[model samples]
Target chain A: MSLDAVPVAETRRKGDVEPLVRLAGPDMAAVDALIVERMQSQVPVIPMLADHLVAAGGKRLRPLLTIAAARAAGASGPIEAPVRLAAAVEFIHTATLLHDDVVDSSDLRRGKVAAHLIWGAPSSVLVGDYLFARAFELMVETGRMRALGILATASSVISEGEVLQLTRAHDLNLDQATYLRIISAKTAELFAAAAEAGAVGVDADDATVAALRAYGLNLGLAFQLADDALDYGGQSEVLGKNAGDDFREGKVTLPLLLAAARTRGREDAFWDRTINKGERTEDDFRRARELIVGSGSVAATLDLAWDYADLARDALSALPASDWRAALERLADFAVSRVA
Target chain B: MSLDAVPVAETRRKGDVEPLVRLAGPDMAAVDALIVERMQSQVPVIPMLADHLVAAGGKRLRPLLTIAAARAAGASGPIEAPVRLAAAVEFIHTATLLHDDVVDSSDLRRGKVAAHLIWGAPSSVLVGDYLFARAFELMVETGRMRALGILATASSVISEGEVLQLTRAHDLNLDQATYLRIISAKTAELFAAAAEAGAVGVDADDATVAALRAYGLNLGLAFQLADDALDYGGQSEVLGKNAGDDFREGKVTLPLLLAAARTRGREDAFWDRTINKGERTEDDFRRARELIVGSGSVAATLDLAWDYADLARDALSALPASDWRAALERLADFAVSRVA
Candidate 1:
């Protein structure tokens, strides 16, 4: 289809894909189709549950990093490695989501009922396990021990991050350092591993691997910060979840932590009622949101996200100027700017 | 210490293994210490919950298979592989136990509280996931893909078997073949994998690996059958569980299924009260046990267990007359004769 004929809204933002879509020329369509095909597999109820998320249509940012990283490394061909790499990333993400839903007893995910709610907790748990195991099998079929080691280590870190989160839940005493540790383990580690292994999948050298890893790490941090911002900012529609869900869950994210710190003595009753006691009424959410918004923590959090996004861009500067590299640059913008 | 110094009561049974104990020597002590050490690492409430089951004290059959298989392969140094192997098997077993308790909503395990009962369901679920991930990492350090493959495949089979059990639950129409598949996947697969991987860890030859696998498989099947028989034979103390707990859970084990078949026209009411309706009272247990025993299914089940035990012994017949092999032969007898 001609670019002019494409739907304006369905296309990424105005500047979002304009530069990179031109740079991508032809391979981007193939990459997108490859991801979809790879996502389709028969694993009892797991595949159906996964499709709910995979097709719920979040930006496929991790796989994009993978393909972009492969291309930025100056490798060219109908190389199947990138496809498997993309599939592996998706699998890891899907597996984590399945477990996350169970861990949180979450009812809604991507604007749909969570897998655990739909399929029961046991099926959801086993399916998550199945996907993780299958992801390992995919990596093994790639014939790279380095890739296996990278992915396996990331999976362990992911689990650890989750445990850390579980431990810290409902604790209002949590700080930015602990929050950062959780995000790095829970989210950024997989992002870093995905980009690192994407380059490694094509035998990218140490320098390239390091660059892509840094890129993914920064981008992932920024991505999660933006997610926290969205949670408080009432960007519910684009984010595909309810506004103030985090506050309801009593999670002390950056905004809440900063707001609580700034108010210190004055909002002790608010913190006690919302965070510690978990008795958040609508008035509580409104008051909390107003407090966080008024304290400038929302913009401050966004500032940090932008800083990380800029760092992510800087990490990509070492790579050659290619369409894939340009697409990655656009991705940092999309990740930080999206309501989701 | 000399063999005579060890307790005679622990070695006087029909399947007694004074020889294997002597061969194991100090290593048996080391393995036991490691088991306790590893079990203690489950942090706070988890460790307390795990201790309940650990102290309930299984035969440690899977770990013993690991040790014996390694020894049978003529490995004579650095028992870490066996130690690690045994630990990994226990971790996998413990993980499954946690999941099984959740799936079955089981209140008692070995006459003690289930992990889910002691810890909340979510905590039990995550701890199970933790143990599984820990087990994988430990096995991965072994650096043998074949061993990892065996274990990963067994884990998948276990999940599949559990799902099969779920789907077949309360369905009295289930046949012998499906029942065998369920048990094979849920029980024997892990046992076989443990033995085979133990052999693989020590670089056992193909023939030895095959023999150990068969031995473990037969022993596991025999062990489960004996457990089923005990449910009908008034051996609650030996099993560390209530007599006819399987019937209470609406599980149609070999003895129950055979009796149902023999009961013919009476099967409908039995099925209604037991499997389908699931309103099993003390009287229900009494009548079920009576029917199973009176129909001679318990004897038939015991015969089947003996057949597997004999097969396990025959599998070891070609091995050189080593103390380890002799211990394994005795283990086959013990597995069937334990009545649990």
Candidate 2:
């Protein structure tokens, strides 16, 4: 069931997020309602713009993971703690998206116009700040100081990762280690914290807490690796998934790093022209996609993704036998099987 | 005497910040060192970019106010609480500056090239985030949960105000009440929080906390109003302060709002062309300045600023007459006299 060799399919597995959603189903609605309530303000634009993005569909994967982790650790406490932390995680995630779209000049997110596009960049940045501040306020409501510290540290690490990525833009020398480092901070930090915060909410033991953090961290790495591969053209024979047009944007993800590593710099300047200099044309995107697939970098990326997914599975070995734990195990499978 | 009719003077009064600094002098160094220490990280850019802006100094007025207020309220704690909160306040201010430059597309800040100009918009945005996150970390170190809540709420309100201003940009119909609302949230929230947090650090009584909050809020309003007037034409033959440029940048502050209110619809379209459309030239800035002065909005802005200064003075009437309280009272006078 290895997906490394898959040619062109890269859509999210339909039920990958569902198992966790169902496991955490009880608190999902409450988290969603709380998000809407906390984001409210007298400033009409605050709610209008926030709702526009918040309501737009995305798998509520992060919060679901938080709730599941909390439950899997045998926390029977009122469920309020996990619910609040889940909402806070969603706020942080949404806030980052708003800022990211502005930074990337993204025209669309989740199939709608980006918030920046609709509200303008200034509003997007400012509103992102609003959401960020709101996220902390929600964190404070949990009254768990340790959980607050985890989320706050994650926020800082994520910012540092973003800065690193920004500095490395168009940098042809980006290696696997550096790419992993960046992704770990930008993407994995929140995932790890989201799960850890839940465990903290329930007063999970240190061993269980560490296990949950590891689970989240490795799963995040796997998730990002799969995403990078999908962008380069991960498709199944039955599905011909759209190769995400990331190379054209000069994004230096894992596949691009592998592709560059394999090349001998013969086309370094040409790669530089499109990927580094941002002199992109439609023709360049097609050719870049061809290079990525032809070089077997797609397979390499997925193989690496599988390795992380395995680590994620291994992290759960110490957890107690429970339906929620089993669901988390299945979620790991979905993380790697996206391309299969 | 009010400085309304003065033209071209716009520097903060020389001793306004000094008294507070001297009063809080003991903790100032530790706060400075802590900021440099906490901002350090594995990511070189975090420190490099943070230092670039942090070192290119402003008055350091906010932190001084925090420390002074803590001391004024008889804070006998380790002084660590106020020091940490002071650093956090400064970080928040710095982070906002980084983001504000990107939103405003300004090339210069503190007479130095903005970090965005040196690095880029993405770095500016992300590093601002790093500082904001670091701010919370420092806030947590105080272990004064109530103080943390105050700072967190201020951060949210500040962002809401910024978003409100962004949404209201180029809006010619912005009224006095709305304009005040925007500045109060954008600028005054932090000032009020800084003083309130300092008092909270000392476990000050509810009455003392109220007094400090009121003092900071009115001082903030007076400071911002003077700043607004200073940008238009607040100067004297002796002071020769540089008229801070706001009109050319399309900011719709109190002076411009008043000026627009005074003008009839005939010139309204002309104002729209320059302010609303952001179509400014050297000649336009000059003309805008002339229009602002000719409308007598400058004097009116200062008159309103004096009202806030008086309120700030009245807020301290309840405090025990300490040297620190007198310094704060003098600070209000200096806020109004900056342009005189």
DockQ of each: 0.29, 0.74
Task: Flag regions of model 1 displaced more than 4 Å.
Answer: A1-57, A78-86, B1-13, B17-22, B25-57, B79-82, B110-112, B232-237, B240-243
Q: What DockQ results for candidate 2?
A: 0.74
Candidate 1's TM-score? 0.86
lDDT (10s digit) by residue, model 2, range A206-312: 99999999999998998888788777664433122234546656878988777776775666776778776788887876677777777888778877877787788
Candidate 1: how many backbone clashes?
A: 0
Error of 1 at B216 (Å): 2.3
Model 2 over residues B94-116: C-alpha lDDT tens digits? 99988998998876777677788
Each candidate structure's TM-score, on Cα atoms with residue i matched to residue i, is: 0.86, 0.92
- Which DockQ value does candidate 1 get? 0.29
Q: List the residue pairs that clash in candidate 2.
A: A8-A234, A8-A235, A9-A234, A9-A235, A9-A236, B6-B235, B7-B235, B8-B235, B9-B234, B9-B235
| Top candidate by TM-score | 2
